[model samples]
Target: MTANASRAISWGEASARRMERQFLARPAGRGTRVAEVVAAMLGAHAQVLSAAEVSVGVRAAGVTRADVRAALWDDRSLVKTFGPRGTVHLLPAAELPLWCAALTAIPTGPSPFPPDVRVTEEQAAQIVAAIGEALDGVCLTVEELGQEVVARTGPWAGDLVMPAFQDLWPRWRQVLHRAGQSGALCFGPNRGRKVTYTRPPAFDPGPVPEEAALRELARRYLRAYGPATPQHFAKWLAAPAGWAALLFRELAEAGAVEEVAFEGSGAWVAAGDTEFPGGRVRGVRLLPYFDAYAIAARPRESLFPGEAYRRALAGGQAGNFPVLLVDGVVAGVWHQRRQGRRTTVTVELIGRRLTARQERELGEQVERVGDVLETKAQLVVGKVTVGPHA
Candidate 1:
């Protein structure tokens, strides 16, 4: 019924439109700024520092690694925190209040742990509070913070250890994400070689009702990766499908978004943002692992056709190796090896060939990648074996 308001948009058209929305088409050139780029992408993945830097560099033209670092550590304009899917991401610090409020609003259900490892609601609250209090004015390493948490909340917070990935982890560590989502904790600049944590004062505009927060998040997600189904939003945010579907309905009712047909399946886009012009996507790119642009796109089949998805994404996991993009589709997988000042970028075209011009552009992109890393890059075009992310 909602689709009646908008015509069907082909996958090709959608891809081109995404390139524009994602800044892949226009990019944040010299005139544009890094804040705008970060806001547009929603957030840049920062699990791999270099990957995050390259992600920002690609979109925010002429931005150096130092610029990004200053944004995070010095200027504090961008906050490094655990975001979407509980992954490290760089978010505009000014938007932290809204993001924190929205993310905390999502109901995480009851604790799934067995009694032996389960933390009571009261204990969890105390642990979260202790983490906040401990890092109010100073940063502390994980171990140091653990000690502070135990001092504040008592030994129960530290004594409880649960099995996690072959190693045992403190029960209170489970609430680290909750602390970040609550806006009471964030990443501090590394002290020498050790990671540290701090509590950045955030503006809490009182209580942001769940409905309001969900609506805002939904709107942003659509703007960043529109022509997407509610399922995609749910998957991206790790929210319940039924809950996401309900929010979409509310968004449609309020005229905040419009429904479009994506390959005959229903999709939603921010109202008045359904334009998908032809012949927009051009050139080649080397998108680093877990690049926000690559991670946010949905309907995997449309973005990665044939065996491309299987090769790039294994068992539904993305970011094994840097992806090679021809136009807007995944053309191959690539790996980068750096030693001293030289970086080697190895490309493996998976049954896809490029035009001479594209090859040149790819080479230029390799150079740019090197610049992002401050290294001299040597590109190797050959057969690259694909496998799981290390």
Candidate 2:
């Protein structure tokens, strides 16, 4: 923190600066590598893999969904795995070691399941190891992997204890994410419609050490979405608030971070990351479902101001509605429906008005979105129906 810095940065300016840092206010994400975009944003949320590709594509110039898949499966530059909050994400493959160490270092809470259904710590470790061994040098569907895991361990490991969708999941399934966070598992190319799992490409971040890995991860988050607090980070990682607060204290004592006032509240930014961009970030962008910026940015009220505060969020969660961003704030909600070779983009601008020039920019942005998805996009100013993706 700059000692007695002149003035606190307003929430508006802070939001604009974050846009620049996140590559939203600049040229299509400043790099060609899909992994580059993934790293900058920490990870692309991948519960919907196609949406994940859009999250990356909109950030980078000339990149497409195929490019994201190539990085994941062909070039192996991006690894599909459980990342922050144990949600499916596409993380930079080379950073798996660091990601694994930092993620595994997060403090965990007690299980939600009853004792009869719960996976004990010893059982979890054993199952994780079995998962690693079963997927090494080969790709296997969940059923096939379950067979191998049961064979390697015991039938007790395969007891259907966890309820998922319409069926029950095996006891070992609880550790599936742990296996990925331990760098022993990742996603593989789909065999037709069936998904497959495989081991990471044999790189480990153990040399970085957990403490160092965590420090770097903190710095990365601050650099991309900073002037933030540990609570925001804790929420992003689903880690404990106390654990996150302690981490910030450590960073502060080491002089790796500086405190600054953000909207009158004290926040920390990475050391030397003091420059705030001048003027508002003027642009109209249609961000896809689960876009990192929508999910990770701080001060939700400011990000989703006015009517946007209600419409853009679902159950107090961001990323449910595809956002129509105007000058770094959520101004509306949009939806994309792709049929064959064309994508129809329906946007409802709320809470703000646009100039003629800004409206033109919105049209161009819609066209760029089509380019990202490799489809011809038609823009319509109307209500966006929120349901399953069309």
Which candidate leads in TM-score? Answer: 2
lDDT: worst 10-residue window of model 1: 1-10
Deviating ranges (above 4 Å) for candidate 2: 1-6, 29-31, 204-206, 388-390
Residues 200-253, model 2: lDDT tens digits: 887753456899999999999988888799999999999999999999999999
TM-score of 1: 0.94
RMSD of 1: 2.5
Writing each residue's lDDT as its tens digit, candidate 1 over 225-281 gives 888888898888777888778888888999999887888888899887766775438
Clashing pairs in 1: none
- Consecutive 10-residue window with the lowest summed lDDT within model 2: 1-10
Q: Which stretches of candidate 1 lie over 4 Å from their true place?
A: 1-5, 109-112, 204-207
